[model samples]
Target: MNTLNQGSQKYDVAYLKQTIIPGKTTKGQITQMFGAPTNEELNSTSTSNESNWTYEKTDEGLDKYMKLAHKYVSTETSLKMYETSAQLAKAQTVANDVSSVTGTKTGQSQTQGSVLTIYFVDDVVKYYRVY
Candidate 1:
């Protein structure tokens, strides 16, 4: 399978939620754990010196389609390699099932990911959210 990255890093949201605590975790500590952010920006709309750091991972192309194609091809090939009637019958059944499933259409969602953003102020985490 292929992977597409929209930013500099990827993150396990569950781990982040459990580890990173607002008003507790320091910016230095966050960097030590998750590495550099995809972007660093000051929250212009806010009067305080609040900053936002973003970490994002996005979908890869053709992964779903390739998996479906591989399933169908492998099942059909197994039908030819089987020497016994029972094996062949099983292979045929598998092949039939695989054949009926269609690949994803264009513009269909292949995978899903959420951007993990940490908001900081005074070099400490103020709050965090996934967008």
Candidate 2:
């Protein structure tokens, strides 16, 4: 049998658009919705002093497999069961060995995460970008 498992953590852009308004949303409101930012920076420009808040998210994928094989080695071995007792013995030996052999294989993949940068002016959201 084979199996696959995938996991991820991310932000909702549409939800952000609805919740974060350029002139109305405050730093406290953004923090409430997204938790603490991954990183923060302050900038002083000719006309404005602003802050940049960065948020990040990641995704991962995985694949798993199981393999099994069995072999029976006996002096009394035959292809026709009813024709000979040797065939029955060989069949029994194979059935007995079936539980002893097995193997497993696993594979994994990952994707680069998404990043969102929110620019704040006077503690209010000025603009944002997602990549």
Candidate 3:
């Protein structure tokens, strides 16, 4: 017999969002304040400013996994983005480097937003956030 217990924890996206003011803050600054971000972007423009910085705090899900004896897969519960012109510039640089290395196209048609998806197979994490 298997019993499941999901432990509760505090998650505040608003508080995280409050840590920085977009356009004024850089990705480095945001990371310094909030630690390494799950993701980072650079060289993008925002309505408020010409650049943006973003990060996400994902639930580790270990607690839930253990509770269910690793039987269940979880999806992202929440996500947030931060804006900074400096960060956007940096992200653009990094993306350029990646494209150069992979011989991929320099620009994507969709500039507004990027989507990430994670795939699993046989109850194991396979690939994630493949754009």
Candidate 4:
């Protein structure tokens, strides 16, 4: 498939909302919840002096290309590949299952990534935004 860039690991919006709460969540909690952020800024905005912790993952919708790739790969699972026959076959089967719609539908834009920016003042979460 044609991928622009793999970018960072995926983030779940629901998980973030459920775990993090502004005014109550602490920096340690945020860090523990999502691990080290993708980036950090001393002063993210001119108007605010609060430290901004950013966790981001970007994807430009791979549904179409992924579908095409799935269609192509499904037809090749039986064929012998570079990897060991057992390993290759198993890998191919799993890949096909994800796009086969029996498991995960990778050809959906809803599998998009997220960018979470949490503004901190005195180690407590002042505000947060997830895009």
What's each prediction's TM-score?
Answer: 0.48, 0.49, 0.27, 0.46
Clashing pairs in 3: 42-88, 42-91, 42-92, 43-88, 43-89, 51-84, 51-85, 52-84, 53-82, 53-84
- Candidate 3, residues 1-131: lDDT per residue as tens digits? 12221211112333323543433544455445544434434333433223222332232234334435323433322111122434776998888788878888444422222232222232222333322
* Model 2: lowest-lDDT 10 consecutive positions: 62-71
Residue clash pairs of candidate 4 = none
Q: What is the lDDT for 41 in model 4?
A: 77
lDDT of 4 by residue, 2-77 (tens): 2543322325555555677788999898776666776887865555457888875532234334445555674565
- The most accurate candidate by TM-score is 2
Model 4 off-target regions past 4 Å?
1-10, 44-49, 58-113
Worst 10 residues of 1 by lDDT: 104-113
lDDT (0 to 1) per candidate: 0.63, 0.59, 0.36, 0.62
Better of 2 and 3 by lDDT: 2
**What digit string (tens of lDDT, one per residue) describes model 1 on residues 64-129?**
344344567677664554445468668867765665565423221212236778899977899887
Model 2 lDDT tens row, 1-131: 11232212224456566677898999998877677777899886625679999875431122111111112323233233224545766886665455334322211111223677899988898998876
Candidate 1: which pairs clash? none
Q: For model 2, how many clashes?
A: 0
Q: With candidate 4 superimposed using the best TM-score fit, by how many Å does residue 27's alpha carbon deviate from the native?
A: 0.7
Number of backbone collisions per candidate, in order?
A: 0, 0, 10, 0
- TM-score of candidate 2 relative to the true fold: 0.49
